[model samples]
Every structure is written in C-alpha cells, then in structure tokens.
Target: MKKLFAMLLTVSLLMVSAGAASTQSSNWAQEAVWTAQEAGLVPETLNTSYDTAITRAEFCSLAASLYRIWEANGQLKDITPSSVSFTDCTDEDVLLCASIGVVNGVGDGRFAPDSPIQRQEAASMLHRLAALRTDYAGSTKNKMPHVFFDGENIRSWARSDVYWAYNSGVMTGTGDNAFDPTGQYTREQSIVTILRLYDASYAALPVPNTEAPYHAVLDYSGAGVSRMHLEDKDGNHLLTDFEDTDGYFYDITVFGDWVGLMWNDNANVALYQPATGKRIDGYIFDGIDEKNGVAWAWAYDDENALVVYADGTTGKKFIPKTVWSEGRAIVWANANTLAAIDKNGNTLWQYKTSFNQDTLVYGLGDRVVIEQDNTNTLLANGKLGTAQTYTIIPNKWSANYIGGDNGYYTLYDQNGKALTGSYANALDEVGQDIYCRWVSDTQYEYFHCAAGGNPTTLFTVTVTNGRPGVLPTDGAGVYALQTSQNTIACFDRFGTIIGTIQTPFTLDSLADITFENGCIRVTRMDIGADTSTQTMLYLPTGEPIA
Candidate 1:
C-alpha cells in the first residue's frame, strides 16, 4: 500500500511537464518545481526565482493559482468569501487568497506583501488549505498528527494548522529531526507543500459548520421581575414555553438541548429540560454551572466549607465530585468512600481512601481521572487503572494530556490511545477542549484540541510569559487568554486572535479571566487587601461593559 501510494504521488507530480521550465530549482526540488509549473500552480513571475526565498505575497499568488485550478477542475466547492481589502497590499492574488481563508494579513491592516515567509508560516497557510480538502477530518475521526523534535518553537496559535500540515503529509521538515519552524522557505519549497495540499483536497469535505450548538445565557439586568426570555441569534423565540421564567434569578445560562440550565440566587432551583419540556431535577446553591450535562456549584451556606453536595444528575446525596459525558458521576458516597454512580444513585465503582478534601477529580470526555495521594488514575468502563505519579490535565470535552515521569506528555483520547507520537511539555491547565504546553522556559503553546471517539478542529499559538488556563466553560463565541503580563488576546472558536486588550494590572494580580454572558470577565486580586474584583469587557468589539 505504501509503495502504491508513493507511486501515485510520483505520477501526480510528474504530470504534464513536456515543455519544461525556463528556470530551475534546487536539485531536490527540480521535479516538483517543473510539475508545479506545468500544473499552473507556479506563475510566470516566479518561474525564474525558484531558488530565491518566497515572500508572503508571492506565496499567496501561488496558492491562489492552485485554488483557481481546483475550482476550474470542479474539485472544490465555490466559496464566496467576503470582500477582503488590505491597506499595505493591493495584490489581487493575495487579496483573493485572504478572501478564501488561505492566508491572513499582519496586524494594523497591513499585508506586508514583500516580506519573506517563514517555514512555519508557510505550513500554517498549507494547513488552511488542508481544511478545505475534501478528505479533511473536520467532522470525522482523525488519528493523531505528527510530533516534531522542536514543536515548542511552533507558536500555540499556529500549532493546529502546523500539526494538520504535518499530520496530513502536506509539509515536511528540513531533516535532522527538526521542523525548523521559524526558518526561511524558498519558492520551490512552498510550491511543493502547496502541491501536497492540492493532492489531498481531491476528496475535500464540505466546509465545517461553525455555528454548532453552544450554551447561551440570558441576564435580565434586573429589569423584569424574575423573568427571562430565550431567543436565537435572529431574536426568534427558541423556548416559547417560558412565558415568564420566573424566580429571584441572578442569571440563567442554558445549553441548546436545554438539559443544562444554570440559574441562581434562589433558595432552590429547578432545572427544566426544555427540549422535552420535562423538569429533570433541581438543587440549592449560590449558583449552578453545568458541563457535559452535569451541573455543579458551591454549598450555599458556609461558602468556604465543603458540605451538603448532591448528585448533579439526580437530587440524591451522592455528592458529585466530578462528572463525565458518561452516564455516571464520580461522587463522594461518604467521608471516606469515593464512588462512581449512575443517575439512580447505584454505585458502579468506588475508591475507599481518606481523600475527601485533598483529592481532585476531573472529567476527560466520558473518562474520569482521579488525583489522590500524589498519584493520578484513569477511570473508565467501571474500572480504575493503577495510579501513577505523573502530571495529568484532564479535558472534559476532549483528550487528556498525561505527562510521564520524564516531564514530557502524550495526549490520550478517551480510548487511552496516543494522539501524538512525540511527547510535549504539559501545563496543568484545562479549558473547553483547549490545551497548553510549555514550549520553553518563558514561552507556552496554546491550542484548542479535543479528541474523544473523534477530534475537534485544532488551533494554536506560541507566546512567552503567559498561557495559564481556565477550568472549562460553556462561553462559546469568543475566548480570552492573557498572552503576556499586560495583554489579553481574544480568539474565536477557530482560534483566530480577533483582537487583544491591554490590561492595567500585572500578571501576578490577574487572578482569573473568563467569559460571562458574552463578555470577557477579568478577575483581579488585591493581595494586601485580601479582596478580589471582576471587570467585564464586551465581546467581539472588546468595549468596556461599563
């Protein structure tokens, strides 16, 4: 099979080069260069500069040509991108590539058309092309992508696309066990990578639907009397049954299935599964936050004391420590007994240890992870594996990153299968399918990746002195991360940095950053005063809420 695949690839590259090129490329890329030229992927302007370094604009022109060829050959779905105009560049091909999402401009509305392109930047563009490929694993199962020797050099924001390029075989390294992520790339090298991306797009899946269901919140802003309304983006009523969602409610956040409804401030709260129009169950707390169909909150009275916890699924006193997508939740059956029980309060598995307060339990998709006695154990299928003292960060909606004793980690899907062959330095943080790894002493890599039975699309960035994380949240539209001591970068689901906010406080004082009801909620701590305050910035526009 490998031999056949290699032969087919060779034949594809060797097609239609009868007239040959007037200029030449490196000895290694001679054949690929001519093939790209004959296939109309190489323009006449670049025909003589095969050995020279490729500029950003020049590469986009090449990509645009390839895109046009694919569209003409009926290989791609016609995409009508929005009008893309750049201040520093008016190159038609570059603008065309940007319109179709093949590339992006530098900040401050400039295209930098004449600037040279880096190898990783080139891979990033190729990765974008991979997304449009018919066989791109957007909504399907994707086995792990490749791991490189210097993955840390790849920025967290570009990691997803870079890995996709590597995993899909659209890009290759400069030999000697390195991707040379920041190294310069010549025109011939760019052409070959683009050709690989072209070959893989033959089975391109339809562009992924970005507007999948996410939890939405409604805050009355204290106007109506304990009342709320639910509507879609177009202001169409989604839950008309709630003529008046009455209660002394502080706020309400509902998932699309409406199985998870978080409301607050009342003595008790009743959760209604709006889809079925049936009341699932209810509990009393200061507030309720749900994930993977399980709602949790702090005890109402004695806020600092841990007591009176109940099952998230049922109102029984199982005291759900953590819940996974699985039908079961790991609960504290009693003071000294930890157990996994179903919705009916039946124990499927139990761990008897004096770890009521010290232990931490987190969900990684349908799997459960237990941290007790300085060891971490993987729990699944009603069984617990032998505990090991390796660092582990559990992602409730995707794969888990388990670091070995060597301090290098491998990402594991729910099946406990390795997601990357090469290991990376793991950061003990979690988010909504978002993971960060230590890239260097001062730099951290952040990427949104979740793999269970399948994988979510990946987005990444590399930054220094930042990238600490958040416990998962249902805040869907935009995510904010403090990228540096005084800068918080905001990103969409695709992991694009839509905008950034310059913060006033130092990194040490920034306690937490979260998204609350479509705003960036930044929490800051005053150490001497022992007080914490939260500030909100509106989303998309990042305007101060006040």
Candidate 2:
C-alpha cells in the first residue's frame, strides 16, 4: 500500500513537470489573469509579461486595490490582518484577509484560511448575527432557562443566548441533547438564525399595516391605548423619545347600560365602566362602563348635521350617527339616510331619509338599517320597507371624536358631494390611484423609503440578510441605522435615514410599516421585551426613543 501511494505521488509530480509550459499573462489566458485589462487587479502591461503562472507576490499586489476603497469609506472595523506572515504570500494578501475577517493569527495562534471553520466558532458567529447575547447587559438570566433540542451539550457561557435562539426559531436543534453548539453552523443555518432573531412578524402588523423598525420604542398605544379607551391619530400622543410612555386616547361611547371604547382606527377596545375601573388621566367624561376587567366610555356626537342652507332649507337636520367600521365611517340620519365618510372627514355619499325622526338608525353600507319602536326593518326610500327587528340591542350613537388619537374635533359636512369620482382602489393602503411606489427587496438596492421619501442614503445597516421584508434602517437619519454588524441598510431619496430598527426577527413575516404624516406605526412581539406589550406603537419620524 505504501509503495502504491508513493508511485501515485511520483506520477502526479511527473505530470506537472511535463505540462509545465510558458505562462501567458494575456487577456486570452484561460486561467484568471492578474492584469487590469477589464479592471483586473494587476496592470495588464505588467501581468502580461509574466513567463509563469501568477506568483503569490503578484496576486497580493493585484488585490491590494481593494484596500483603497475601504480606506475611502472608513477603516475596516471587523477585518483584521492575520498575525503570522506567510513567506509565499505578499503583504496585500495578508492585509486583504485581515480586512475581511478571514484570517486572524499565525503560528500557534494563526488562522489558516484553508482550514475548515470549527463548528463551535461558526455557532458563536451565528449567535452574534441572531443578536443572541447570553451575558448581554439587558439579559436577565446568566444561563438560558429553556431546554434546547440539543440542550445538555451547550456550554454554560453560551447557554442563555443559545437557548433564546433555539426557542425563537433562530436555531433548530439536532433533535438530540447537543445543539452541536460547538459544531460548525452552515450558511443556511446562519441565515435562518438571522431570520429568526428578528422575525418578519414584528415588521408586519395585520390590523393596521404600520411601519415598525427593530430596537425602536414603538407606540403600541394605538392599539393598547385604545384598549384603555384612549384614541389618537397615527402620529398623536406617541412620544418618540425612548424615555417616555407614549400616551394613547380613545373615544368614549355609550348605549344605555352598555358603553365601550373605540379606537381612532375604528377597532374596539376592552369594555368597562368609568365608575368601576381605576381612572387614567382623570376620567371626566359621560358614558363610562366597565365589564370583565375591561373599561370603556360612551362618546357623544358633537358633529353637526349637514343642513343644505342653499336656497331656503334652514332647520338643523340631525346628521345620522356616524359609526366607523372596516375602514370607512358609516352614518344613517333618518329612515332613508345613508352616507360614507372618508378619513379626511369628507362625505363620500348621502341618501335621503323618509321615516319619522324617532326612527332608530344603524349603519348598513348599501342600505339603511332602521329600528322603529322595537321593530327593525330595511328601509329603501322609507315608506313601509321590509319589516325586521333587532333583539341584540345595538349601542346608542355618540358623536364625540377626538381630533385624532389625543385631540377631538367636530366635523361638519358641506351640502356637497366629496367623492367626485369613484375610487379605483377600495383597499389600497395609500390608495390605488395615488401613484406611489411598491418596493420589493430588489427595488431598494439603490434606495429604500423607510419613512417620508423615495431614497435616503446617509445611514447604516446592521444586519441585512437580503431577506424579503426586513426594515433596512432604524428610523433615525442622523444615526446611521446600523445592524450590530452593519451589513444591511435602508435609505430615502434625499439621502436621509428612515428606518434602522433591528430585532431577532425575520424579514419574511415582518409587518408592513405605515408612515402617516410623520408618525411610524408597527407591531412587535413581547418576547421578554416589556416595550412591545401592545400591537402598535406610534413613533415620531426621526425620534423613536420616547
């Protein structure tokens, strides 16, 4: 066996010697040339004159150009040159490897680029990308409490974050007692780790489709505050300074013994009575009701009816009670009244009311929902209509609307049509006819709109896995929204930062962020992060801390 191996080695060397031919350093060279004919690393004139295959020294000089690009931007922070110098390799080779974190040392401490990356080391790096910090300052436990698929083998030091990563789906176990924590994690494993850290669900809010960035102090008050009967607009009440509790406001409403709070976005808050539950912000309004530990209030309708003062109509006509549903506000004034109002407080349509003033009304989109005495019926033009009655007993109509989330303002409609033309998109976020942009991951390579523009440039990206829907930057332009690694970034048109929120979440499930005015709306998971107990947070455009 030994003789056969030696003979095979001898034949290999003989073949190499026989095939040794004059080296051609021209563009026509089959192998990669070190020349710069097509922006090659080496100058074509010099590289073409070589009589042999490019030597290690020549390759070093050829590749040194990349150093200049790095210098122009900033010092390579993560990449460091290998400690040990190789006799065969040039300075450029050592420096290039150092700058890219490929090789770190020499001799006993030398990092051999050709050597396989150890499984343990790979797992450690993977942990970093996943933002899993076992001894992190914010960490509550010294070791992770959860059991891993490969639980027993994880080192005590790495146990905390390792456990977090596995439970969060950032890392899957080997289905055994050892996660191979010391084992090399593959590229796929690393990507999955990054994806799981900040899952896509944090970026995507199902109810409101709001904008959410990682590490940003979101304003869940929009949903949570609304639950407390506090209603406000997208940008209202949210203190973007990371230090303050973003305030939330809700519309108080009542229907006899039943009262509930409604949110600015038209979602129902937990119901309770003002007389029973603890008062927040000095409860002083009518129609307060509490039930099942939830508190709510009955709001009053302050908006005046649209009285067509045109020729001679002068009496104050009761503007049907407007109730918000789905995304539009519906109202029914009299038996024959029907109308749809948009977010801008503009009336989309209005129909006549033929029944008496005492007739009870409900908001039914295409038709009128009328309740006379105890009898409920569908009123066409109001004469007798189809007879029907509602036993469920709907809540009474109140006209109190805070301006947005915090402030309330009364809206009076003009006796004119608001929707001059039909909307092409009934469900579009910005509206189908708005001619806005639909950005997938590809469209944002050159630029991404995190908040108020087309493409912002001046910012930093920490973790960019090239995922489909992760936010590119934190919401601040002044501080480069950087991932802990500074790998990915999102920018706007004027070269300002829009978003740079990072999380242990994936881009695939991230909620779409909605930037209304200057406020950003997004949802986050409450995974030990007390900040995201609610579904939505309203942060100011560049000020997300508060």
Candidate 3:
C-alpha cells in the first residue's frame, strides 16, 4: 500500500483569480471560492497573510465547505460530512478525527475534541482515508525498482496505510520517493489532500444537467438553418440572423466573417451586417445588373459560362472553362493566383498575382501572400483562410491507410524516413509492437512482417461455418484471433501461434483503445472496473500480466 501519486490532480487550466474577498466581492455574492474554501481549505492568497491569524473556527468552516462541494458534486459518495458543530475543543478534535476516518465510536461513546490530535491519532485517520486493503491491493516489494526516503516515519502498525495511499496516487513523496507519515498535517495541506481524495472517489461522475455551469443554445428550428447566431460563453444571445433574409434560400455557408447564402429558383439573397443589420450586397458582390430576384439557366453556348441562379438570370458571371467541370461553381483563392472557380463554373473573386505566392491553401477564407513549395491555391480580397482545404501529403504509409482518429499511423523505417511503398489501412500499435490485418472483399488475414513495413506472409483466419465474402478487418491483414468462447490468442508478427490467455475483461462496445500512462485505456464502457481486473496481455507469450 505505497502512497500513489497518481491521484495527484495536476493543476490544469485553473486560473488563480482574486480570492473570495476581492474587489468584486459583494454582500449577496455566494463566495467565489466557496467549495474549496468552505472545506476548511483556505484559498491561496496572492498577498501574504498573518501566519497564525486564521483561527481553528475558520479552519473548520473552510473544511466544511470543501466537504460540501465535493459531496454536492459527487466527489465523495460513501462518506458524508456531519451536521454537528464543533465549537467545543473536544468536539472539534473528534470532528477532525472522524472526518479523516481515524476512529469509530464504541457502543455509547463521546469523542474528545479538545485534545490535540497526536501522531498516531492522525496516522490512523490517514490510514483509513487512504482506503488500503491487504488482500486486494498490489504489492510493491521488488515489483517496482524504487526506495522510500521517509520510510522510517511509517509506524509498523500503519505501514499498510502509508503504502496504499502512496501506491494509489493519493499520497506523493516529498522527494526521493518517501512518505513522511509522521509529519503533522497543516490546515492548508490537510484540506487540499482530503479534497483530492474526494475528487478521485467520483472522478468519472457525470454532471447533472441543471447543475451544469454552461449550456449550448441549439437552433433546433429554422433560424439555425437559414441564419447564423453567435453567443457568449454563457450562451447569451449575442448576434442573430447574420444573413437576415426573407426569400427562398438554397444553401448557406459561413467562412469566417464572410457568410454565403445561395437562393433557390428566383429569390433575392441579402447579406446584412451581423452587428449593424445594414444591407451589404454591393460590398459582398462585385456588380448587380440582372433582375433583383431572377433564376439562372445553363449557358447554351460553351463560350458563355452561365454564372447565374437556379431560376435563369446571370447572378454572377465568370470566364468559361476556368473551374473544375464536375464540382460546384464556388471559387477558391490561394497566395499567388487570383481566384479559383468552383465546379459550378462561377468566379467568386479575382486576386492580383504576387511573385511570392504560396500554393498551400488551408481553409476556405484563409489567405496569405507567401508562396509555398507545395500545392496550388489562391486568395481573394485579404480574407482569412478556413481549415477546409484538402491537401494530401505522402507519409511513411500511403494515403490509402489513414481513416481513424489518430489520422494516419505512418511507420518509419530504421533511418526515421517514411518508407515509400509500405502502407495499409488496418494497422495498429499494441505496446511497442505493430500489427496489420489485411481486409478485402473475401476475408481478413494476419499480415506478418519482420520490419515495420511490407508484409511477407498472410495467415487467413477461417471461421468454421462463418459467413463468406465478409472481411471483418476490412482487408488490413492481421486479425486478432478470438475464440468462439471469447478467449484471446496472440500470433507473432510472422502469424505463428505464440500462446493463449483468458480475456481479462470484455468491453461491450469499445469505440477506441489507446495507450496512456503506460496502460491501455478503453473508451465507451458504462460499468465495471475502469483500471483494475483489465490487465494487459503478454503478446509474445499470450499470457495475462500477473
């Protein structure tokens, strides 16, 4: 039961704002730092305060706040804070002792609150709070190569307590991997530690909808479809109806500040200032000569590119054969070139070419003047780029192999260069070893390879009486051999049977499995042990990690 520092909640994204009593403090304001502060945990002050000025009463009150916040937020479930006040010295001592699970009451007993909590007294409480079980917990002796610095502080009786907390990430070492169990807990230190344990107790708890600090104002109706609205962080309605149109609409797309609304048939499409609500048609469009609301017809002659609406009039005209034949008429611009007409055969804008035009166009509205050594794209009228451009770069693997969330896993050769020809879609890294399963229209097989790339052998998995022409692994090469009885077997990179092991646990619907903190974490499970009982299987031997 070594102190587990893994429970240590790294201070992430927490802004150290002004404490509860700052310039913004008001008579009716609920304490800003109420949760941590009420837990008898003092808010970290920017300015120095009197060393011993804070009284025992204040400490208890703060501790109470921390306890309440944790409980209300589902931080601690099994244990709850008592409602009894501890003004008397005896009562105070008892409250502290019981809060940390130091002692339990005999038949008809009274706790001595006035007495100073001793080393043994505190140790007992810390031990229980650490939640150590002799039989169920992991053993550290020789399992990990390490030594404790303050090993002497742990009494023989409370050694298990100290060890459990250390191993469970609850208690961390001062330095040199040691738990100073005998050290007196400070008011601040104690409150912080207890709050941490509270956090770990219900780390996976979901927040209630009513208690959620923020929410999204979803446009379930027509407005979210036709018009765009911007809201504040607290979902305050800020900007509404950016387009502000009342005619037949075809499609609307937002590319940065530029919002495009295409009209269907023959409808007047108006662009309004999101902030001012003024008509901004002239600024958005270059010229307006056709009818206010007219439909467009396809160009009868190839020389005249029809750049008009679906009804018939020329809404926006451009040169013929400039854009792609199959795609829409939407135009895209890059650094050096002026404009790019979409497959729709309409030129959106024209840009003056610069000498150092970069071909790497990223998003829809993103535009810069510098030329890249890569792709061809352009920019129009000093607008920002959107992250919608599709550019495919050659990787350690081929473009055909990337589809998952990790984007694409390109296995590098020993020289750390991308191997030109080796690529497959169904490949994954389990531990340091990589496995590839070949999937085709017919079946899936284990693709074995000595190096990271280029499979040498394929072992087809034949499921007796199984469906035919259904490659479960999608033609990638190797299939993780699972028995009909749900047992796990490991095959070498060469598709040779290494060994077999019982499946530690069955994940009902694992959307993803990834490695983090030296362990494999499966996402999308509703119940069961998130960490324990799900041990990593030994691939080389096909044995469970015991």
Best by TM-score: 1
lDDT of 3 by residue, 1-546 (tens): 112221221121123344622322222222212333344444454112312223333334444445455446655536544543333344453465356554544324444332333333343454464342222234442112112433423443444454445444444555423445555444433444454554555221222213222222333337345433334346665433333433224443332222334443324343333333444342122222111122222232322333333122233453322222212322334434456453233455555544422233232211222235533222323332222222322111111221222333344332333332333444443211233443544344544343445654434544343332212110111124544234544343235544454554654334233322112233334455553333353322333334
Please give the clash total of every predicted structure, in order.
Answer: 13, 106, 75
User: Each model's TM-score, in the order given?
Assistant: 0.36, 0.20, 0.25
**Model 1 clashes, total count:** 13
Cand. 3 TM to true fold: 0.25
Model 3, residue 40: displacement in angstroms?
A: 4.0
Q: How accurate locally is residue 408 in candidate 3, as Cα lDDT from 0 to 100?
A: 39
lDDT of each: 0.57, 0.33, 0.36
Candidate 3 error regions (>4 Å): 1-246, 254-259, 264-355, 358-416, 419-421, 424-438, 442-546
Q: Model 3 Cα displacement at 545 (Å)?
A: 36
